[model samples]
Target chain A: MARTRLTPEREGELYAAVLDLLREVGYDALTMDAVAARTRSSKATLYRQWGSKPALVVTALRHNKPVSLAEIDTGSLRGDFHAVLQRTDDCQMEKDSALMRGLSHAVHESPELHQALRELLIEPEMTGLDELLRRAVDRGELRPDNPALKYIPHMMIGAIAARQLVEDRAVDQAFLIDYVDSVVLPALGV
Target chain B: MARTRLTPEREGELYAAVLDLLREVGYDALTMDAVAARTRSSKATLYRQWGSKPALVVTALRHNKPVSLAEIDTGSLRGDFHAVLQRTDDCQMEKDSALMRGLSHAVHESPELHQALRELLIEPEMTGLDELLRRAVDRGELRPDNPALKYIPHMMIGAIAARQLVEDRAVDQAFLIDYVDSVVLPALGV
Candidate 1:
């Protein structure tokens, strides 16, 4: 069956199941058959709806996001950055960090998965982030050619990904807000 | 059967084999039996020598590093940061990035692996980094209590890890050097 056939409630359940399976087994080990078994759906139905494992997995990941970065406009870069964090529940960051790490390796091995993830997930988030920076630049808050501009994603990702690795700490909102104020904002001369 | 009894050349080869197995498979899927088979050594010797899978893997990971961060004192934080990269061959950075990404996920699951990796691998790197930062602070090049002091590792790690994920680009020594100049120094007010 098509994805639209499912009610919103059914759709939410399926997406949650897919993400949980991904966190447990990773992309290489995850199978449409396993997804089917977990969701009590048929493999053909999944394949029919999403076209491939990568598409299905990426769609589920997208659905998990609580807010879109593109929609945020708080009139200041600091406000936008903090607002982005405000939208994401504090508890979700740790699990999301773990999930991204789990996929980081898998992304290296599968071009389709990488493409799907970027196109569906990372690209939009990046575009939204770029827009936020653009607005800041428009307001004369940042230089147009700051080399650090390109590295915002890297810095943010590093903060989220490296926190657990280096310090054995969960990435709570408090840490991220501080990170933005002390590290990110200063580096950008904001 | 002890690792001490092996010739230095043989020990290096065994360590190389262990690292190769780790890269091809991840920590959880990797086995002592696989390491033994790959290296043409007996599993008993492996256990007697390294004690466990996590220990053997961590030991091999340590052996692959070309420089010890603690041994480097370039007399300045920037010089030492660049020196650390100088010691690591540029060609190896991409592979090391992938290996770390691979391990990042597994590190979340296995406490033994986490302990061994932090104790054997990450801790020394942090210490060396800390020494470098201390030298910087002592020289009055940076503020003693700068919040960004703790984030150097996270920033550097992010630059390497997120390059491929975000930009689909390989991180070379040149890229790292530029990162040090652009993002890192400015953040530190250096």
Candidate 2:
């Protein structure tokens, strides 16, 4: 079958459709046929573009994530952390949580999906975070070899995810601030 | 239909079958019919005993967990944490990780499963951890009103889970010790 070229706008539509289907039916039950039907795109085009269900889903997740890490600088480590936390709060709406929950099992089951999620979706954010932390180290706000540096992403993001999972509570701005002040800053010896 | 009374040993067998099936097929794909076929138990008996697939899976996870908090204390908070970490290492074999990954999406989708997981598998462990922390506070090893106390579970377990999900690394005894010493202890000002 000849491939139909999708414009950037059309690509975004397909991603939105995939994410919507993910929220409704979840990863396992979601099918390529459903995505094609929802988006009014050809199944062959989807396969041609993304190869498989895991590939399409991974690409959709990556595409949906706000990958701009350019505006995260805030001078001090605490300020930078707070800024990032605020950004996280802004992006992590209920629908995003549902998508994350839906993909959680599939990510673990498929190495390709896990790699794509980590590298494409999660790594950009982590890189941005690390850059902020590195600036703090350079500015003498933190020590060069703080062991807690290794755990910042895991600590902050994990706390947010775990809170939602274990307690069903949203990690709002207030909670993020509290987490930074109580758990993160203290652990870093700030 | 007459209900079959399963002995404690038979009940254990059924739980094992459920967990095994969950590992093989995941929460959404697993069926009561499959469970009945695997265990050679009547579908009516399974329904009578567990009510639903979520209930059965939750019960199976709870049953497999080493639920005794009685053996967690080891005098000092550090010692107690180490003991608990060791037990966690022993219990969190490859199979357990697989089950956890399998159930991650389902837990979010079903409130019943989420509650059952927290109550049965997670809460018992947390209660034990909190008791140890409380004892430490009473002994003046930690401040009575430290805010970081609320986040200990999230930090430790979250780090372990995050490492597996992102880095594909096992949360071994060494890593747990490092986490407790560097992250947990320092945050507690111990």
Candidate 3:
């Protein structure tokens, strides 16, 4: 007797294995053979599901990303930013966070991956943050026109990512909050 | 004999060859054996000059990084920002610019190299830009209590680098200038 069902849970497991491979071997070094071995799936299965490594990688990242922004009713722009940063802080602390290292490596090498990453990983979060800022602008918690607003997401998330990519150290959440309040808020003239 | 005595220019040529080897092989793959073979120099000579790959790579970067920042005498803060962005535009156009790729890779891989890259390559430019901004603050071109000042350099450079790193496209100078004028200057209340 054998478990013959290809369940959704099995798909999720395979996708996670792809992420692990992407992180361990990097973009250039990642191979289907390795993914098959790691996932305990046949190479035929990977090929049947995803045509190539790029497709598999893109699919993995799409699944790996958070489905949507947290619905935060923190009542202030600063509070919203804090909530968002805290969520991101938790994600970065995960040991198997391919979102930071592996997928980023693929982005560097492939334009298609980069575009997919921005669309899947960056855009939805930014759109939500933008909506939050819009509400703040209406409420007078923030200036209507903040230049730093344009770069805040990049600075907060991208700065942490950039530092992680460089130092391979855990990001300091307190320092990030201070940065938001002292540097980002004041810059926005909040 | 084709040549017996090596000129100073020949020494510089040998160093350039070592750098070319670095680009081809990357830091970890680069070796004194490869450098000596490529440069047609004795292994003893490379060992006598630069003891290790890091030293050689650092030397090459120091020698190669073109005017990280030039003093801009633009009396207005807007003028200085515009000027700096223009220079950044030019630097971003070079395809074979090892300084960009190599330093980026080095910074990501090694902390010691990151510190050296920051100190040697980035700090000088930041210092000059800071001095220029300090002068602007002194002249009342910027607000005294502006916390955005800290984020400005990171934001400006990060936008350019992030766009390039993710998008694989050249940063538009006009768009950058507009971004500064419309978003940054207005946010600064200048």
By DockQ, the best candidate is 1
Identify the superior model by TM-score, candidate 2 or candidate 3: 2
Determine the C-alpha RMSD for candidate 1 after optimal superposition of all C-alphas: 2.4
Candidate 1 per-residue lDDT over residues A1-190, each given as its tens digit: 3668788899899999999998888878999999999999999889888999999999999999988998999999999999998888777887787678778878988999999999999999988988999999999999999978888888888888778878888899999999888888889988
- Candidate 2 vs. true structure, TM-score: 0.84
What tens digits encode model 3's per-residue C-alpha lDDT throughout B1-190?
A: 1233567688668767866776676666777788878888887766567665665666666555444545686889898888776764444544333345544545556777666656655566678877887888899888778755655654555555665554456657775786677546755667
Residue clash pairs of candidate 2: none
Off by over 4 Å in 1: A1-10, A37-45, B1-3
Error of 3 at B79 (Å): 3.0
What's the distance in Å from true for residue A60, model 2? Answer: 4.0
Once fitted onto the true fold, the runs of candidate 2 whose alpha carbons sit more than 4 angstroms away are A1-14, A28-59, A88-92, B1-11, B29-56, B88-92
What ranking emerges by TM-score with the best candidate at the front?
1, 2, 3
lDDT, candidate 2, at A36: 87
True lDDT of residue A52, candidate 1: 95
Give me the runs in candidate 3 sitting further than 4 Å from their true place. Answer: A1-12, A65-67, A94-99, A133-153, A161-169, A183-190, B1-25, B32-51, B68-70, B88-99, B142-146, B165-168, B179-190
Candidate 3 all-Cα RMSD: 5.3
